[model samples]
Target: MESTGIQRLFYILWAIIKLNLYILVFTLAGGIVLGMGPAFQSANDVLLTSGMDYQNITFGKMAERFKANFKRSNGIFWIFAALLGIVAYNLFLASQIKGLLWFILSFVLFFAILLLLVVYLYAVQYETTYDISIGNLLKLAFISVFLNFGTFLKVLFGVISILVVTWFFKGLLLFATFSLFLVWSGYATKNIRQLVEGKLG
Candidate 1:
């Protein structure tokens, strides 16, 4: 039930990479959706004109729309994030770590990435403000969490290399930076898990 430092690092790296890939995908999809998707097009115009649309539609209508939009093909961003958390689960389990802690680590890791992505995207794309429901966000996060690991690892690895050399690469820097964060996040997460399980020497 002990994990070595090197093992911890690998899982950490994998976690971060997958997390960033979710960001990249989400950024592009969001660009198309909230950014320019036909469905969300009027959303911005309405906001700009009225200053708020919260009262225009019933909360139920808003929830329904959120569910429909989040399940669209372009909504794989959160799915990727959720997958990253599962990676954390595997890393701990493989190292013989156990208990509710694994699930908590995975959830926190997934949540942090999801929160960071939402904040970054809102700041980057929205004018002054926008309305998004939390229920859909959670749904997106779960989709990402539930993806297959082999695919997730490949994505995670790609992000790590990019992040490590982003400044030099220029055009790929966003991808690189995103990758770095995921890897770092994974490392931080694994270390925490190790400490909790008393695996740290």
Candidate 2:
């Protein structure tokens, strides 16, 4: 029998609120790192570069290290997501659907791409002149990944896609990215539950 809209809404709400604390633990940890790492690096550069040591510290070298670190920092996020996927796969024995896998895979790819682009952004900053070519590509790649993750990004895209859409918008675009996090969590929960039951039961 087809479920009523009320029932569906209830399910979604249940999923969203059910032990949100646990989900946020992982998400927030990842999000915080994603949000703060760059600022941290910038501060690091400022602090260490003080007292007339700026000449020794080259922008080109600094950019590469920063880009690589950002890529790896966000790599940590993807690693978390991948772990979630493995857990889900273990729980659910149902035939895999292309639809759901698409979502899962897309998220991974997008996250990784964003990380790479961020790395590239820092990496390119060390160039001799103020050339925008490298920075532009990094910006484009960053926005593409952010947009792939959620509905909020869509709304965000609609607003800024025109002006900043040329290469991309600056700053972290994760403002409302957590809106559908519950859905991702729910899907992960459901599949993992299925996989666990299949093995144990």
Candidate 3:
């Protein structure tokens, strides 16, 4: 019998726990060594590997991609750092100028950064699945978002739904939250690729 989407998602979670223990450990270590940027990218690495339908993946292979993931994460870190810097500067200006202009600018930039974050979430999946360069990945992310705006919403919705689920099961957050997130990301990333490739209607 064929499995349902929930079953498949659970299987993806199990695969991560079972097959990618080293990656999980490294994820924790990366978070400590370099901050959550590398850790987030490490999770993306697992999401990409999970896209492979949980087959023929080895720790050595995932480890080989570490440098690339770290590089990608480093770029992401700087982008976020810049975003934070802008927000901080604008807020300081707002306090001094006593005007809405700086506050508005900061607000707009916050949403802009947030949008790019969601875009990059999808883009990293593409990068892992296709080994696309960062320059091309940015292009691909925008194209995917423009062409499949509805699909993009669906991906974000899935993530939010998962967060709600985890919120209800707060006790599991420590042990299972990351794994559950990977499962959805893995599944959603695959679908996003299909949408981008015109394979899904």
Sort by TM-score, top down from the best: 3, 1, 2
List the pairs of residues colliding in candidate 3: none
lDDT of 3 by residue, 1-201 (tens): 356877887765666554435445656666745534555565566555555355644565556656567767667656656766776666566656545776686677655655565576666566666666677777787677666666666667776786788789875555555555555655665655786668423
lDDT per residue for candidate 1 within 1-201, as digits (tens), equals 256777776654444443334445444555644422212322222223332223342334423343354443234334444555675565555446456876676566655554444332222122112234445444433343333444334444554455557757765543336445333333323332233236313
Ten contiguous residues minimizing lDDT sum, candidate 2: 121-130
Question: lDDT per residue, candidate 2, 51-131, as tens digits?
Answer: 123334344544443554465335434444465565455434323435787667656655544455333323222221123
**Clash-forming residue pairs, model 2:** 67-119, 91-192, 91-194, 91-195, 91-196, 92-195
- Deviation of model 1 at 181, angstroms: 5.4
Query: How do all models score by TM-score?
Result: 0.25, 0.23, 0.63
**How many backbone clashes does every candidate have?**
14, 6, 0
lDDT of 3: 0.61
What's model 3's TM-score?
Answer: 0.63
By lDDT, highest first, what's the ranking?
3, 1, 2
Candidate 1 Cα outliers beyond 4 Å, as residue runs = 1-3, 32-165, 170-175, 179-201
Error of 1 at 74 (Å): 16
